[model samples]
Each structure stands twice: as structure tokens, then as C-alpha cells.
Target: MRRVRTTHLVLALRGLGRRRVRDAALSVLAPVVACCAALAGLTAWAGAGRAGSPTRVRVTEGRVLLPSVGVPETAAFFRIANEGGSADTLVRITARDVPGDVTLSQHRMERGDMAYRSEIDSVSVAAGERLAMSPVGVDLTVPVPSKAWRSGDLVPFTLEFRRSGPVRVLAVVVRPGTVSPQ
Candidate 1:
């Protein structure tokens, strides 16, 4: 009877030891598994929308000039750069702050020093080139809102492209004849 009791005690001790070892191993592996899961999530997020193509179009230096005294319209300018291997066309410009549709217009000087403004459909930017819009050249004609505009207001504008999709930018509002705050 004493021998039987000793054998049972030894077996119970061995089972407890095995359970402790397994618990230690699981505790050490928990953090490693969590880290691996976090790394995989980050990798998947970074690879989204960049599988086979690169972002090659960049828009910068955006500014909007406030309308002068009695003028009912204003102009916005931007510097668009295309760093890709092919050319891209700027298809549309939209502003949430303004109520009316923003239109692309060109300003040209005629024979008598008079300025002519005409609405254009689209503008193209060549590869490895930049298109700078100024008051004397290509610009976006924005209708003046009913509310009074301050000098240092910020306006959001979205520029859509043929191949590069949509690029969003914030344009600074400046009084007419004031230098841009780019």
C-alpha cells in the first residue's frame, strides 16, 4: 500500500511540471505573435493603391486672388508638375467653398496691350515639366461668393487629372495685386 501511494505522488508531480513548462512557453510566444500580426497589417496598408503604378503628378504653389472692388469674379493659380514618363492633362477643378463651377481660363495680351480672357476645356502638362499659372497666363476663374472674403483665408481646391486621378490642395486667399502666400 505505501509503494502505491508513492507512485501516485510522483506521477502528480510530473504532470504539474509539464503544465508549468507549457505555460511559460505560451507566455513568451504571445508578444511575438502580436508583433507579427501588427507588422503584417502595416505592410498591407502601405501596399494599398500602389501595386503596379507610382504617383508621378504633384501640384503645388496654389493661390487665390480676391476680387477687386466691383468685380464679381476672381482667379486662382497653381503650379503643376508631372514627374512621370508620359504627359497628363488637367481635366477639372472643383472648390467646395465656392458655389459655382470653377472654370479654366486663359489670359492673353492682344495688339493694343488689352488682355483677353477665354475659357478652355483642359490643359496638358508634359512629362518632366511644370505648368505655372499666373494672372497673365492660364488661371481658374472662380465666382465670388456672397460672403466677404478676408485676406488670409484658406480655400480648398481639388484638381483632377486624366491619368493621375484627383489631387487636392489648399490655396491661400490674397487681395488683388498682393503677392501670393505660397
Candidate 2:
């Protein structure tokens, strides 16, 4: 009787092992397929971000000066670098603390006199070239006189671009002879 019971137990164990062979293989396959799917999804998301983004828009230099009220207007100078692989435009700029609105202006000598004009929409900055918006040649003017800004006072402003959007910065007001901050 003991020998018959032992043979029955051995047959039951063999049946259990045969039933799990397919299930054991599927467990490993499930994890492998899930990992591959996750990797594919991440790769596609990264590609989409790169396709839409512009390469880079940077502020090389920005400064604001303090001069006498009789000067008519004060100017801020900046150097914008468009490192993006494509061309972009400096569309508009705004300064809030200033008493008047901002305008992009250019100065040129015509017929033995200095001619000044406003830049309306945008200033093009080529892919690799630099756009130098200087106070002397190309200037950004405040239409009215602002409250006197002391040295070291921070002037906050935003420069808007065509493709890259707006960049906010603080222009440190300094004396005429003092060095400007970066």
C-alpha cells in the first residue's frame, strides 16, 4: 500500500511541471517586450522636441545709461546672438519702469545732417551673424523722461523675438564713464 501511494505522488509532480513550461517562458517574454516598447516611445518624444525648438537665442551684452534730461532721450544698447541654425528676427522690446514706450531707432547722416528713424517690425539677425544694437548707430529710445535713475539701479526689460520669443533682463544703470555690468 505504501509503494502505491509513493508512485501516485510522483505522477502528480510530473503533471504539474509539464503544465508550467509554457507559462514560465511567457513570464520572461512579457518583460522583454515591455522594455522594448518603452524605449521606442522615449526615442520618439525626444525627436519631436528637437524638430520644433530653435537652436539658441542669447544675450551677449545689455546696458542702460543715465544722461541729462535735456538730452531728449536715453538709449540702451545690446548685442544679440542667434545661435540657432536658422535666421530669426528681433521683433519688439518693452521696458516697464520707463516713463515712455520703447522704439528701435537708427541714425544715419543724410544731406550733411543726421537723420533718425524708427525700426517698426523686426531686425533680422542672420544664422551666424551678430546684431549689434548700439546706442550710437542703432538705438532703443524711451519716448519720455523717466525718473532719475541712480548708479547701480537695475532696469528691467524684455526683448521679443520672432521665433524664439521674449528674453527678460536687468540693465544696470551706470555713470557715463563707469564700466557696464555683464
Candidate 3:
């Protein structure tokens, strides 16, 4: 009677499909596998068209101007140097610590009225040129107030390039009306 009961228990347990264990394991592991595959693809694709290293694009003298007494918005300046054999386009700029979007803007004279316009889509850097970002020319617009920005404050900035990927920069905050060098 003991041997017969053991055999019946074994048969009942075997009734559960053996493939159920494999299915459950696959369901748990599929998303992780897919994420790894997607990351690998992006890593390969980012290097497809770039001929030079990402370090060729450098940012120097990066600063965000402190907002004046009445102005709430501020401007940023940077000297972007492309020391590579291939030209690259600065496609995007992002700042996580700020409250507003970092927009690429340039002053335009429309109908004799000089205005700061957010019309620049992207800025291009030649093979061996240093693009000076200034308030008179193309600059980054941000909502950095005097309260938020102080002298010697460092803010994080990420500049995305068409060929070089993204380069991280630390922008220093300067005093109000600090004139950027020409």
C-alpha cells in the first residue's frame, strides 16, 4: 500500500507540464535580454558615421550669465572647438538643473527691431574652427534667475553632436553683466 501511494503521488505531480517551468523563466528573462540587445544596437549605430573620436569636440570658457535685476532669463556662452578632420553639428543642448528648456537662440534684426529670437535649429562647427557662443551671436537661452544662479556656481550641460554623440560640460556662473570676451 505504501509503494502504490508513492507511485500515485509521482504521477499526479508529473501531470504539471514540464514546459511550464521553461515558459515562466523565458517570460522573466525576455525583457532583460531585449534591453541588452537594444543597447548593443545603439552603441553600434552611434559609431557608424563618426570618423573621429568624441573627444575632438571640446567646450571652453563655458559660463551662464546671471540674470539682471529685471530680467529673469539668462544667456550662456561657450567656446566650442572641433579639432577633428570631420565637421559636426551641435544638435541639442540640455540642462537638468534648470527649470526651463535650453534653447539655441540668436539675435536677429527684423524690420529694424533687434530681438532675441529662438530661430537657430543647430550650430555647425567646421573641421578646425572654434565656434564662439556669445550673446551677440548664437547663445543658449535659459531661465536662470539671479536667485538660482550665483557667482562661481557650476551647472551641468550636455551638448549633443551629430557625429560625436554627447559631450558633458560644466558651466560656471558669472556675475551680472559680465561681458564675454570677443
Candidate maximizing TM-score: 1
TM-scores of the models, in the given order? Answer: 0.67, 0.61, 0.64
Model 3 lDDT tens row, 1-182: 99999999988777655567778888989899999999988788567744444537888888988677677678888899998767889989999888777888877656766664665889999877889987678989887643566789898999899988998999998985675545
When 2 and 3 are scored with lDDT, the better candidate is 3
Ten contiguous residues with the weakest lDDT in model 1: 46-55
Q: Could you tell me the lDDT of residue 146 within candidate 1?
A: 82
Overall local distance difference test of candidate 2? 0.73
Please identify model 3 stretches exceeding 4 Å from their true place: 1-55, 110-113, 145-147
Using alpha carbons, what is the TM-score of model 3? 0.64
lDDT, candidates in the order shown: 0.87, 0.73, 0.81
Pairs of residues at least 3 apart in sequence or in different chains that clash in candidate 2 = none
Candidate 1 C-alpha lDDT tens digits along 98-181: 979999999888998999999999999986789889888889999888887788888999999998999999998887776432
The best-first sequence of candidates by lDDT reads: 1, 3, 2
Stronger candidate by TM-score (1 vs 3): 1
Q: Which runs of model 2 end up more than 4 angstroms from their true locations?
A: 1-53, 70-72, 113-115, 144-146, 177-182
**Residue 35: error of model 2 in Å?**
42
* Tens digit of per-residue lDDT, candidate 2, span 87-153: 7888788988877778887766578676656665667887656777664466677643456777777
Cα-based lDDT at residue 165, candidate 1: 94
